[model samples]
Target: MSPALTAEIAQRFAAIALGHVRREYPNKPGHVLAGPEDARTPRELHPIFYGSFDWHSCVHGYWMLAHLLQRFPQIEAAPAIRALFDAQLTPDNVEGECAYLAAPEARGFERPYGWGWLLKLSAELSLHTHHAWFDTLQPLADALVARFEDFLPIATYPVRVGTHFNTAFALRLAADYAEATGNGALFSLLCETALRWYGTDENCPAWGEPSGDDFLSSALVEAECMRRLMPQDDFLGWFDRFLPQIEAGQPETLFSPARVSDRSDGKIAHLDGLNLSRAWCWRALGKAIPEDDPRRSMMVAAAEAHLAAALPHVAGDYMGEHWLASFATLALEA
Candidate 1:
């Protein structure tokens, strides 16, 4: 097992975050150009989230910083973290970000992925009680919430991929926000959608896995989403049927960590994330089961194995460095 999170690790992770959160180039801007004027720098396009490789990665990177700062308020990074929030989360900046979203050409801008993380960031900041970050960021976050309210009704089928398109991964984060903030309407919609999409899934084919750009496990993320949306008893029963072979580890792919041959190539780097996220799912799944369940051992072992595979590689390349820590933090916390 890994060591508990400490102030030192928290500061180091915060430093990694600060190093990239504002370094605006080598960027992957995921936007639609409505006119020639739209082709500006990342900062001009997104004043708050113009760093950390891409918009979603940057969004979650900020989430990581805020999460760590809140957890370890005495860490050296806390002051800088607060200052960054003060600077970037201004009403003008947030309104600018929202204006981009209101653009008619940008309906599917970040879709469920970035949209979910934006809410997660909002939820994280809300924990900072008297702080201005949450209220300042709420408008942008609400814009995404509105997008979700609009998007989920028409999104009858969940996107089952292992990347940004995966609807389950998005829903899991969105569920966190809905629950934390007591958004009854969104939470109900999420639960209903999750049950409708995955309640009947059984014997998921875990093989043919690890697509080149897969940072998610389609099977496991779906299980995670269901776990969030359903009651513990209902989730356990559904999980048993969904991955019926877990006790024996029959669908071995789910138990094995992915191998990353090239961390420098952005797409290949996703294998590292595949490993970390699998660990997150496994650890979470393990906790949801009983002390004596045979599958719990399998799940724990799988989580550790995946953690071991990916922990050392969380750095060393820009492609992976931009966002791998968020997943690593998720797995480590699990």
Candidate 2:
């Protein structure tokens, strides 16, 4: 990385750290703590203003924090981030129990929505930060394993669905955490479960059938997890086959656009925008792309163009600051 790029990454990381501390968390869970100076007040956050917090929003925040920490390891913030996540451990914090949330929180609501959210959160936190603060995750893993038979057959709405991306997230998390914990059996179990979803055969045909924006996200996540766990040769082949489509600037059938209801705003389709879906591909491919491939440069150029366009629209110093800055860092890293 060039000196200029290095400096930019550092600034962006600091901004993310500061913004979360100052704004987003101030009136939420970590309000009592010393956060960033520019923290968003309770009035400014719409959901919180309405007296409710989206479970996935909290999950996303944890994921972003993990991403930033992986880039810039800070011992000081580890505990706080860990604690913020800890707040949602109860069942009340889970999914439907927002109405039942009270006093000491319960292990996130036991429903499919909450369990899926927690499963993803725990896996990412452990995988990214390598922090053991949530020692409870071990037993939680055991419980999930015991209950796997119940959650299988990934269902649609009202059928206890385990989301595509979220399930993919769980697979990666479980694999990473299993390795970290030296639990070979658990690792294998997680891998097998994930494979059941993405494997090429009839067992995982559902996972392979690309159908929606959510499915595509899940597929990309599956691809990433496969990249991490599968042999390098297989991963390379996967990349070689699909990357050409990306390079050609054509959408692949692997990802379903139907689930992306928000894309009509044209926020995601435009190359000059920070589309998360496109960034997901860039992130995985950026690390895997061969140095000799001209497509690598094309990917970087596309990401840069998006960054150039999105820079002006980046929300306040803390709201969407980390999301934008981290990608900028990723683009520079590319």
Candidate 3:
């Protein structure tokens, strides 16, 4: 059987997130300072997401915790997760975050990457209807939705990089929020944007994959985005054209796992994330293939290979530990 998300693994992931979600000092701020007065601490800039090394990582860290809590409430970390949410996911804290976003210098702050993660976090919290976390976070989510609506129309081209700037990664992650919250406008916009950007793509070379600092696979992520947003039949047709050689494994790069040379270096640590996220994309896209298709088994094997290469390294180094569990949760759950 494929490695599934067991309660044991969920507990381990939750514990990892709890360990760093609030550790603010070792932060790498994605801030733009317009003046000396703009010089402020990360905690002051992002009250709810000042931990896990950076803002985007911290946002997705909370997402992993929320997802794990919902999936395995009986895990040892459940109570602590609940307590952390109760303490930090408050309206005041969310207001501070929104205010930071509204600043002129912060217009492009976090852009599609952090924007997508914040929405993903909101989507997970929305599942916990018994709590008011989602309600408190709705304003921020709405702000991001507006950002997407405003930005997607003007974004003439898709960012095909295998990194945070990748448009496909953001759209893939944000689709969950649009569907869960019944935001029809956002959903339509996302679908339209994806189709506009990736609809014509055919025979992707995938030559630049596993870029040294990449944490995502541009080719697979775009495929996953279409899988999430398009009708099944339409997505299948698009997939056939976009990656027509999957059955033959012609784009050999997508079938292979990336090697992480150094876990201690933050940029190089991204390879671990690249592996985990490729596993996520493969496992998810695998479900779209027919059972009788040869690509189905290939996808599963590829996912397992990527997971094996990276899962063991999810913890040891602070560089990866601060964020990799979220991607692991995504893969295991998929």
Candidate 4:
């Protein structure tokens, strides 16, 4: 994306995260108003995560900060990032976040989407084994893990949309966490579920992509998730079947990035995320394919195309600003 991530970019991303991770105003709690007693401010509802527009955005905002901090600890923003984590990631705050999630009306609150992000944040922290952040966040992470175990068996069909509900998106993010933490049970479950839901999908209809508010590419995300779980040889075979026409660029929808006409419109801003996420998937799928495969070059080209389209818009409007850097990070890292 930038040849490499620099300290300047790290500082910028960190500053964006720090600006909203604690700015408790102009928020949305996603809380159900059951009664007068149930009414509470966002800070009261989610003590550790009351900023960044919504819960999941805030979760990934932290992920972005932690990710940058891990990669560029020499940046000026590193100290502030560490200090924020030290003050906010305490056991009591996490417990409050967990308690809010455990409420009866919160059953479908963040569901698989936010569940995946929380685990991802935990996984990133897991990389910093010497840091206390992982220990401080373990309880909250464990709570989300339990939710995943309880929910996956009942989610009969995979969500194939290109938005937050996309099953592959959640599984893809959570897989990194599972592998990093050596959660064999979770990893196996993810593999099994991926095979069961998407093992036979072929000749994907990529034309119906970039639905007005879509963020993830359903077809590409599924391919990316399968690539992670399957053996290299087996995955190459499966990918060939999944998008057999890629060599000729038949799924033109994927080769060309979506256009975002309005960064300020929240729903329209999703196109920016769609482009970044597609780039991420294309890069992952590209890297995993065999060196001599012609499709590998095509995939890499498409990934760069998509990255070129969206990387510069990561910090424009509040809607895109709140979360696009994480998507950009995912694409760049992939």
Candidate 5:
């Protein structure tokens, strides 16, 4: 079996996220300044998610910590995790985040990537029934939900990149939030938007995969998005058409792990996340296929191969360390 998320692993991931989620310096802001007055610090703009190098990474870093805390409440870092949430995931902080989003100049700030992670974080928080973090964070999540509601209809074309702009990755992450909150309208919109964008895609060559700065598999992530939004049998048919030669691994790039040349260089380090995210998509797709299908085992093997290549490097360098644990958590949990 592929490596599962054990208490030991959860503890380690929680510690890594906690180490930098609140570390303010060495930051990269995605904000668009409209004027000199808008040129504020990351913390000044994003009261809660101004750490872990960038906003989106910091958002998912919080998601990883919240998920780990829920999965292994007895872990050593549980107290710290809870304390962090209690202090930061408050109404006042959430209001500050919403205020940032309300800015006219910040309309496209983080776009679908940060928007998705923020919702994912909200979804995970909702699973913690005993805590009020979800309620505290709901306003910000609602703001992003409105963004998706407004954006999807006019987004005539999908961004199939392997980087943050990928629409498939955003839809996949946001679906969790839609279902968790029982927002039927958002759920239906996500499903319909995914179909409209990717339904007719077939024989995805994946030739442009593993682009220099890519952290996602454009092909597999779209497949995973369809899997999440479609019914199982319908998704099986779609999957067959999408990647017909999965059993043979015709698109070898999807099966193979990306090689990272330099962990210190942030862009190159994204290859590690690419491997981990590929593992995530592979594992989910593997489980979706019937046990009798030959592709199931192949997908599982591919997932294991990718995980092995990337798991050991999740924390060695600060470039990868600040965010890779979240992707590793996604793969392990998937």
Candidate 6:
């Protein structure tokens, strides 16, 4: 990564952390005081349509903050980041338990967002160099893990086709936490389940018939999950079928028993960059494509274009989207 890019990301991280504490933290009238500062305020409570805690934003915040702290250790030499963390960490909010506080009377809704990401955040923060943060967050990480199994059956409700991406993300998180803590049993079980659910077969795609957005996310998610579990002959064979289409820029439809038109769902290219997804495929298949292969350059070009487009999104130290940091980090490495 160039020094300029690193510095740019560092500043973007600092800015978003500030935004989380400021614009994203205020509550409205007549709500119980869950905490002084939270993603869900009274006026701006999360819609139960997606469940509560709105934890994904918190996860994104922690991700951004951690990357910033790791790359620019001197930032923590100042006090604001720690202040933001402290403000977010309250007695009821610590670790994964924050999700529990979402009682019905208190207007709490159950979703994987709150606890899952916070657990991951606590685990990440436990390792931070800041002694005060390490002391506080390490125990939180351990506690969250201890309670993780209790929160099992994360998705009790029925899942729609597009929602597969969220489940896939959670499974990936499980794989990451398992890898971090050496708990293979849970990770393996989740991996196997995801593989079975999403894995392609002679009869159907792993997750069943999918439209454009569903196809994009399901493929991306399955490809990533397979990366963690390692390649199977079947997955490799199925992926090869799609590679040509993505390369051709007229990629055919996602998995379905009946092959559909390229313009399925109006030929919507639902997503932008496919670098992480493509990278996962490369890692899983354990076969490096030739540099001259159109797909390889296509992936690289997509990433570079994304980075260039993303740079302008930065404003006064804040990047507009959190995922851009991860993408930037990946692209710079590439």
Separately for all candidates shown, the number of backbone clashes (residues 3 or more apart, or on different chains) is 0, 16, 0, 0, 0, 3
- Compared with the true structure, model 6 gives a TM-score of 0.61
Which sections of candidate 6 miss by over 4 Å? 1-5, 22-54, 75-78, 86-110, 113-116, 131-165, 201-216, 231-238, 241-244, 250-294, 314-334
Better of 3 and 4 by TM-score: 3
In model 3, the runs with Cα more than 4 Å from the true position are: none
Q: CA lDDT of each candidate?
A: 0.89, 0.44, 0.93, 0.88, 0.93, 0.44
lDDT of 4 by residue, 1-334 (tens): 3334678877887888888888777776778877899888888888888889899999999998888988988899988988888888988999999888787899888878999999999999988744688988998988888888888898899989888888988888889899999999999999988999999988987878879998999899999999988888889889889999999997889898999999999999999999999999988888887789898899898988899899889896888898888888888888
Q: What is the lDDT of residue 114 in candidate 3?
A: 96
Across 1-334, the per-residue lDDT of candidate 1 in tens digits comes to 4544678878888888898999897999888887898899999989889999899999999999988988899999998988888888899999999988989998999988999899988888888864688888889988898998988889878899899999999899999899889999999999998998888999998776878789999999999999989999999899989988888787888888888999999999999999999999998889999999998998988988998899889888999998998888888787
Task: Write down the TM-score of every candidate.
Answer: 0.98, 0.53, 0.99, 0.97, 0.99, 0.61
Task: Using lDDT, rank the candidates from best to worst.
Answer: 5, 3, 1, 4, 6, 2
Say which prediction, candidate 3 or candidate 6, comes out ahead on lDDT: 3
Cα error of candidate 1 at position 333, Å: 1.3
Task: Note the residue pairs that clash in candidate 4.
Answer: none
lDDT of 3 by residue, 1-334 (tens): 7888999999999999999999996989999999998999999899899999999999999999999999998999999999999999899999999999999888788989999999999999989854599999889999999899889999999999988899998998889999998988889999999999999999999999979999999999999999999999999999999999988986999989888888999999999999999999999999998999999999999999999998999999899999999999999998
Flag clash pairs in model 6: 28-43, 102-108, 198-206
* The 10-residue segment with the lowest total lDDT in model 2: 45-54
Model 1: pairs clashing at backbone N, Cα or C within 3 Å: none
Off by over 4 Å in 2: 1-52, 66-132, 136-170, 193-219, 241-247, 252-274, 306-314, 317-334
Per-residue lDDT, model 5, residue 278, is 95
Where is model 1 poorest over a 10-residue stretch in terms of lDDT? 1-10
Question: Cα deviation in Å at residue 164, candidate 6?
Answer: 9.1
